[model samples]
Structures are given as structure tokens and as C-alpha cells.
Target: MPAEFRAGERVRVRAGDPAGHTRAPRYVRGQVGRIVECQGSWELADEVAAGVAAPRVEPVYTVAFAAGDLWGEGGHEVTVDLWESYIERAERAERAGEDGS
Candidate 1:
């Protein structure tokens, strides 16, 4: 499937904390960040980790979060490679009161 988000767009990490393995970090959940790069399509790590039969491939992105936004105060930014399923459009998240911004 085509990428749902592109570089330079704002996205919010999904906040769900489902049981089992997940690559989405606890600190980043419900946070808004900007997509810095598209890392191309790859097998979904969460599914792979769960030993799914034929994991689905999806777009991965490098997302940058301001340190201040993430942890109250800091000068630098943190970047994380996140699968498409782990994020959604920031506007949508904001409308739903999920962006914590």
C-alpha cells in the first residue's frame, strides 16, 4: 500500500498500549512529531515479533519529536523509525484530543 504519510508532515503516535511486543516507545505514545523521511516499505515488525503467518509490509518513517514537547525541556530533538500503523495525521489526533499538544 502507498504511504499514508509523507516527509514533512505532522503525525501523532498511536497511544494504545496493547499486550504483547511493540516497537512504539512508551515515551512517544500520544505525542506529535514530524515525518522526516520515508524508509520504504518493510514487513511490520510488531507482527513479525508476534510470529504472524505472513506479516504485512508497510511504510516506515523517520519521525522527529522536539525534546521540549517530549520531556518538558531540551534543546535537541529525538528521531525514531516508526511504522505507518503506529501513527496517524496530527490534525486528526488533535481533533480527537489525543495529540497532547
Candidate 2:
């Protein structure tokens, strides 16, 4: 499948406590971040770990989250490689309101 997000696009990590293993970091869940790069398609790690016979392949991306946004401290950003299913496009209107626009 084609990548759902491109570099420079904003996305919010899906927030949920899944029953099984997941690659999405706990701290980044529900946080908004920018897609820094598309890492190409790869087998879904969660499915692979679950022993699925045929894991689905999906787009992966490098996302950059502001440290302040994730922990309320620091000026640096943290980058994480996340699967497409782990994130959703962040709404533009919400972003505008966040920065007092």
C-alpha cells in the first residue's frame, strides 16, 4: 500500500493499550509528530510476533516528536520509526489552534 503520510506531514500516534505486542512507544501514543521520512514497506511487527502465518506489509515512517510535547521538557526532538497503522493524519485545524493561530 502507498504511504498514508509523507515527509513534513503531521500525524498523531494512535492511543490504545493493545492486548499484545506493539512497536508504538508508550510515551508517544496520542502525541502529534511530523513525518521525517518514509522507510518503505515492511511486515507488520505485531503480527509477526503474534505468530501470524502471513503478516501484512505496510508503510513505515520516521516521525519526529518535540520533546516538550512528549514530556513537557527539553528543546530537542525524538524520532521514532512507526508503522502506518500506528498513526493517523493530524487534523490541520487542530494544529492551527494549538499554536494560537
Candidate 3:
């Protein structure tokens, strides 16, 4: 019921603006990550996403990105705290669909 998301899963930040100051950076958009931890659920904070006052609590996940995966060799491994709504399932399914051919 908490919008199922699990660790070791890859996700990318969704489009649209989120209210308040968040650690999820714009450069992180479309960046792939592996869920490291789940923070359960809490009232959707106005600062977390575009402030619309959505009463539903948004689950939070700690996503880890490889330095090389995100940036070039100069980039560091960044573990970002992302909301459940901000993520999309990885493209593995899409690739699988292509592989079926």
C-alpha cells in the first residue's frame, strides 16, 4: 500500500518541480541509482515536492549512484535521498521487451 519500492532497485527522478529545498538535484534527473534504504512514509512535505498539499505521505528511499555511472571519473558516488513519487522503475523491462525479439 505504500507504493511498493525496494532496495537494490534502480530508479530515476521524475520530472516537474518539488517544493522547498531538496537534496534531489536537477542534474540527477534521468540518473540511475540503486535503492539503498527505505524510510517508510510520512506526510508529503511541501518542501519535498511542488507544494500542493497532498495529504498522502510519500515514502523516501536512499538511492546510491556510482561515480562513473553518474558523472565521469571526476564525479563521486552520490547517495541521494529521494521520494517514492520521484522515481520510475528502471528500463530493464523495456530492454527485456526488445530482447524478446
Candidate 4:
């Protein structure tokens, strides 16, 4: 199935450190970014690490974050491939006046 998020959509990395292996990094958790590309479906890393056969799949998205947004300043923009489970639509309050709401 196609991914929920399309290119250009804003998303925030889900926060939390689940027990065992995970691909989401701690630094990127709770950070907002724009989806740059859709990388289709991939097997879940956590399940694979646990040796689960027929593990569930998830869509992967390339998200871009501005350097200033992640840090104080001077850092260049960075893009990272994140699984759908790791991100969600950025909150309405986060978007604020952009939606004219």
C-alpha cells in the first residue's frame, strides 16, 4: 500500500525510546520536518532484529529538516529516511497560521 505522507507534507518524529532495537534516533525524536520523498515499504527493523519471520512492513519517507530548526544555527540541512511508524502529521498548533485556522 502507498504511504500516508506525500512529498512536501510536514511530519514530526514520534518521541520515545522503545525497548530493544529501533531505527529512530533519539536526537530526531519530536523534531518536525518536510517529507522529501517516499521510499516505499520496508521490513520493520525491530522485528527483524528479534528474528520474527513475516514481520510487518512499513513505508519509508525521506524527511528534510532545516539546520536552524534542529540546532541553534550554522548546521546544514539534513535529510533522513524514516519509517511511517516513526512519524506523524505535524500538529495543527505546530502549523499555526499556515493553515489559516
Task: Candidate 2: list runs displaced more than 4 Å.
Answer: none
Q: Which residue pairs overlap in candidate 1's backbone? A: none
Report the lDDT tens digits of candidate 3 across residue range 5-90.
88877776776665565555786777777789897776655453566555557888888887786667656678887778778887
- In order, candidate lDDTs are 0.91, 0.95, 0.72, 0.89
The alpha-carbon deviation from the true structure for residue 97 of candidate 2, after best TM-score superposition, in angstroms, is 1.2
Best by TM-score: 2
Candidate order (TM-score): 2, 4, 1, 3
Clashes of 1: 0
**Pairs that clash in candidate 3:** 18-49, 18-50, 19-47, 19-49, 19-50
Model 4, 11: alpha-carbon shift in Å? 0.3
Per-model root-mean-square deviation over C-alphas: 3.6, 0.9, 4.1, 1.9
- Residue 26, model 2: lDDT of 100
The sequence of per-residue lDDT tens digits that candidate 1 reaches over residues 28-80 is: 99999999999999999889999999999999999999999999999999999
TM, every model: 0.88, 0.95, 0.69, 0.89
Tell me how far the alpha carbon of residue 3 in candidate 1 is from the true structure, in angstroms, after superposition: 1.1
Candidate 2 per-residue lDDT, tens place, 1-101, comes to 99878899899999998989999999999999999999999999999999999999999999999999999999999999999999998988988998799
Where is the poorest 10-residue window by lDDT in model 4? Answer: 92-101
